[model samples]
Target chain A: MELTAPDRHLIAALEGGLPLVARPYRELARGAGLDEAEVIDRLAAMVDGGLIKRLGVIVRHRELGYEANAMVVWDIADARVDDVGDRFGAFDFVTLCYRRPRRLPAWPYNLFCMIHGRQRQAVLARIDELGRVPGAAGAPREVLFSVRRFKQRGATRLGTAAAAEAAP
Target chain B: MTTFEKRLLDEFQRGFPLVERPFAAIADDLGVTEAEIIETLGRLRDEGMVSRVGAVFDPGAIGASTLAAMAVPPGRLDEVTALVNGFDEVNHNYEREHRINVWFVVTAPHRARLDAVIAEIGERTGLEVLDLPMQEAYHLDLGFPLQWN
Candidate 1:
């Protein structure tokens, strides 16, 4: 679905996030040149259409004292990848789960899940718990803990100044 | 953290009210005045604990995105990092503990735009860039409860 100009305006208004006012969407509607109802309707449709993956508060794990962010990759059987992925997703500790193509002879991980904890050992302990999940049991995996974050932000999106310069 | 702040963060990660007076609705539930709710959120944003109180778009839905990695020699890590981070398309760059040390996510409005950015990075760094696009993403709505152990 192609995004319209108004849609872009709404997205632009959302770049920094919702205003800290009671009627934030009204403020957004004003900036986007749409009424409050239309603004809410468009966003609702967008959410239903899967364009908006998540609609809520965005937290910074590091600032919240959950410093250990480990991307745990697993080499699960191809046939059971989704099943195992779902199983991994069930764990409260598994923050993000995905299935990606493996770069053969170099990288063998196809199932990746992220575990965030306040301590490295705590993250590891959760990973151990994750290992017991059905097909994930006894699976070969690797943990790539982030040493330093050079930059961390949400997706670079349309209508943002950054995206304008980056895309063009 | 105050108990109220902890509850607010834990409970409101997702399922944010999309109504016009969202903060008011939250205030009603949290037993605080609307102004207090808004003020606390403002303070959280200033402290960097709350990045935003808004929608998180599907990167590929609104545009093109990929997870790319590079194996930079330790001697030139800083230069390579700065070069990669310079691009607006490149968000969430991290140094992971592996031979493929540098990892980042690049998102753009089009596949060509994303490709060009990745290609340019490889050319400038003179290293083979691994373009690992996400094939599928699975999500679970766990509000990341603050484990106060």
Candidate 2:
């Protein structure tokens, strides 16, 4: 996407996260040298253009008492992955579900989902229940528990200067 | 949890206002002053309950990204992990309890650059990298109910 100077400035301001104030756009506008309405308009436009996804609060699952979390990988039959993924994703406990390419002779799982709970046993019990679900029944799966988080951050914004240089 | 905090968590997971004064709109909906709403949000962030009040961009929408894993020897875990994190493209790194102990998401401005970074990580660490690119996301939106017990 071709970003104008104000667009770049707006993104730069947002990259640090929205300001905590009664008038966040006013704060952003001050930093970006744009009008408060322009800040809102540009952000709304970016959301529409897929440059920005939904503007919402990013909660810390572990801190919120969801201590036991597992990334479950399923090796379902290739033909049935899409159907199975959809069914699994609909479950309230499943936070994330996706289909990924499996690397042969090393990684054998293609479908992945994340489940979180207050206790390890509770998470396991939920996984067992998931196993009995129609589409997931009898599918080979492995659970990888997160031991530690090394880093977690929002997406990196490509500076407009660099983006402009890359553009034709 | 305070009623104000509860309301903030419940109501603002998604669909934040897109208007001239979003906090004013939120304050009106939640029946609180705009200043109070902003203070609570600030406290939520400072307490590590909230990461950000911003957009979570779609993966691979603004850049190329892939899930990569490495099986590092237990003794060399720190060394290899530091090597991987040295790259600016690496984000969301974690140590999982599995043979493939280290996993991370690498994102770059383009696919070719992303591939090159993955290859370079393999060369630097001397560990086979399993590059798993997401084919489809069944649940693209990640906000879920946060139950505090």
Candidate 3:
């Protein structure tokens, strides 16, 4: 959908984010020349439309003192994938879970998940529990632990600054 | 597009100040009121154009695991997704254009358990689960300009 001027303005602002304040919405509304209710309404609509998936705090696991992390990939039977993926998603420690097409030659994972914890042991234990899950009884899986953080930031549309700068 | 949208994207990429009045601070810098900043964010969020506006973190900091993917059969996409998402450790899964179509990330506290989970998945799913542990992260930032129409 072609975003309206107001919509574009809103996206640009969100790309930056709300200021940390007691009443961030009210403050933002005033600056953007819109009412707080409008802002809320727009966000609600965007979320409903799937333009924006969710609005929440991006927890900095590292800053919060989480130390070790890894990525686990799974190849489950096509028939029982639902049963297995659902079981995987049910775990409290598991943070993310989704399905993607299995890559060949170079990669081969059909199902994916992310789990987090305070220590490597804790994370591993959770993975162990997933292993025992009846749904994933015969699925193949892989784990890629993060060695370093290359870059991290909340999602952003890259070239808005240049576009904004180039604007008259 | 208006200046508000431009500034929002630019400022967002740069970083948000972690202060008591972070929004107000941004407003002061941009010569706008804090309310404007919040409203704009709310609007963008509503429009389904952006995913999140919060802290970005290194998964490794917290004992977590992650991975990438390849082709999944067309027929069993939903089933595989359900099984994969079932794990709490699973986060950030997406379908990429490749032979190994299905890609996902998993994080666990320890290595042994992660392996066992992998083993279990192989046994249950009956697919060759290729474990591509991150040998070296050359570049890993997906946040990019969304101006490509």
TM of each candidate vs. truth:
0.89, 0.88, 0.49
lDDT of 1 by residue, B18-108 (tens): 8889998888989999998899999998998988887777655666788898999999999999999999888789999889899998987
Local lDDT at B136 for model 2: 91
Collision count for each candidate, in order: 0, 0, 128
Deviation in angstroms for A139 in model 3?
1.8
Better of 1 and 3 by lDDT: 1
| Tens-digit lDDT track of model 1 for A1-168 | 667677877876786688898788999999778999989888888878877766778888888887888989899999999999888887777888988889987788899888888899988998998888888899899899988889876555663745543443
lDDT of residue A40 for candidate 2: 87
Sort order, TM-score high to low: 1, 2, 3
The residue ranges of model 2 lying beyond 4 angstroms of the native Cα positions read: A1-13, A26-34, A46-53, A157-161, A164-168
RMSD of each: 2.8, 2.6, 16.6
Could you tell which candidate, 2 or 3, scores higher by TM-score?
Answer: 2
* Runs of candidate 3 exceeding 4 Å displacement: A1-5, A30-33, A46-54, A157-168, B1-149
Kindly provide the TM-score of model 1 when superposed on the true structure, using C-alpha atoms.
Answer: 0.89
Best by TM-score: 1
lDDT, candidates in the order shown? 0.83, 0.80, 0.55
Per-model DockQ: 0.67, 0.65, 0.06
